[model samples]
Target: MKPNEKQVNIELTCTEIGGLWGIFIQESMNIRFLTYFMHHLQDEEIKPLTKVALEISEGRLDKIKQIFIKENFPVPRGFAEDDVNLSAPPLFHDIFSLSYIYMMNRLAMINFSYTASNNVRLDVLDFFTECIHTSTEMFGKVVKMMLSKGIYDRPPKMEYPKEIEFVQKGSFLTGIVGKKRPLNAIELSEIFFNIERNYFSVLVMLGFAQVIKDKKLKNHVIRGKTLSEQQIKFFNNLMMEEDLLGTVPVGMEVTDSTSSPFSDKLIFSMINVLNSVDISLISHAMSVSMRTDLTAQYSKIIAEVMLYSKDTFDIVVEKKWLEQPPLVTNRKKLLNSD
Candidate 1:
């Protein structure tokens, strides 16, 4: 293919990727609300925990929305009027909801890892990696809680560790000095920035979902609360590691009041911006392999969030609050002509 043709293909791929990412964001929002709505029946003891998880999911959702806007990409209508049941019976009990949260976090870790590794954009990779760390920590905490309640799942142990012996003819440098190095501050900062952006978005989504009347949706929001708090800490730590002040753009306010604080157009626009940011973060994380653990965690978080966001889209569609964007056909062909 010609250089121009190749460029068009690349652009098309990126656009598709961005759209796919948007789907994830929308689904995440849905999951957040579902968890929150389910937690309303719990006593005071479990209420706080549910609240924390809800916050985290909402915050991440907001970040994804901002990313799409920043990239000038169209954010898809994630949910439709047919997706939610405002009058349905409760879908999950309190303990079941908590277990679901734990499962979602674990899944998030896996997804973050995949994105961090595959994304070519350095900034995007970094962001996902940081998310991975945050999600992992959250998972750990949830697991602890499950253990305390004797509700945590336990798999059978393996027989033994797999081991291999290396040849002994290596030089001193080969044995110790030639190992892979740590990521530089610049690289770390890029990843950190990505994490900060994602966390901000998640918090925003959680705050917005708090007002949904459905018990399942409300429970999801509650679960996201703690995840958001943990993400903030992760971003702060990343900033400190890079010797820089931790700062991330807060997209928009999410409130529980019956009055809408912002127009539906504005909300979807912000979601687009957040999606762009997430892509950037994933790119950065991929540039440096030293942060593998972080990358893995973020991937998982993104995947789980995507599931929940889809649910939220359904809710928005049902309420007729979603704003439609101008549809664009295959623009790649036009790019090739020029």
Candidate 2:
């Protein structure tokens, strides 16, 4: 942009459009949840953390709105105040909201990094870069809060390596049968984090199921909870096979409030989004894992999650809850118009 040269504006690429659209919808939903939690949160220390998170989401929504308006792109009808009930009794304890913010920010960092890396537009790139910075800050604050509360589930500690060592045996990757080499640090880290993620997933399904009144949606959430539980057990078994301590749940309690704080559509959409994120993370785990058995386990878990995600998508579509993304026009249909 210069005084002599006219500013030439380029239309957004498909990826740019998709990234902005997706973030808009997610941030809008986050704003609703954060607003509800702020209404009920009583812990003075955690209240500030929740407030920062809400501010971040609100800012993102406003920025995305500006971009959409500039491009004349239709804004998505994402979740709003009507989707959340501020007066509903607390469905989750204060600790759960803190943990939820921690997990959401972690996932946001991963997603924003990916989206930023793939796009070329200066505005879009800058937006995601700023997002990464804010989310990283929020994540650190939440972790500190969790640690101070003595509730953070730290990854397992290991003794220092005696020396720099290289693999000596062809059996380094073998683990499907007989005695195998002890789990490498990389494999162990992936297993630990994946199990931790599934714990959060289980908590979401468990809490959402209790408040959902629709029989079909309740059953689906329950099924998702069972799937998360099974994955956790499988990952824990892998750790035990190596004589390592397994991951323990964070014990974030869910209240028995049968009243739903969110609309059925919102609850269903939340679960749906959680499942989709789980699949992406599991796929990443598969890529980083080294041991044959660990890779195989990751593969199996991904397959299960993919199948479950499809079922969730089908239900969303059936219930008319799925939002359509921007798409290319059909040239053939245009040419054949009567």
Pick the lDDT winner.
2
Candidate 2, 1-338: lDDT as tens digits: 66454232777899999999999989988998899899999999989889989999999999999989988999999997889988789999998988789889999999999999888877778889999999999999999999999899898888899999988887887888766788877878888988888898888888899989889888989999999999899999978877786989757669989889999878888887888888888888788776788888878888888888899889889989878999899999999999
For model 2, where is the 10-residue window of minimal lDDT? 1-10
Quality of model 2 by C-alpha lDDT: 0.87
Model 2 CA RMSD to the hidden true structure, in angstroms: 1.9
Q: Can you tell me which runs of candidate 1 are displaced by over 4 Å?
A: 1-23, 26-39, 80-87, 158-338
Task: Tell me the lDDT of model 1 at 48.
Answer: 62
Point to the candidate with the largest TM-score.
2
The local distance difference test score of model 1 is 0.52
lDDT (C-alpha, whole model) for all candidates = 0.52, 0.87
Cα error, candidate 2, residue 36 (Å): 1.0
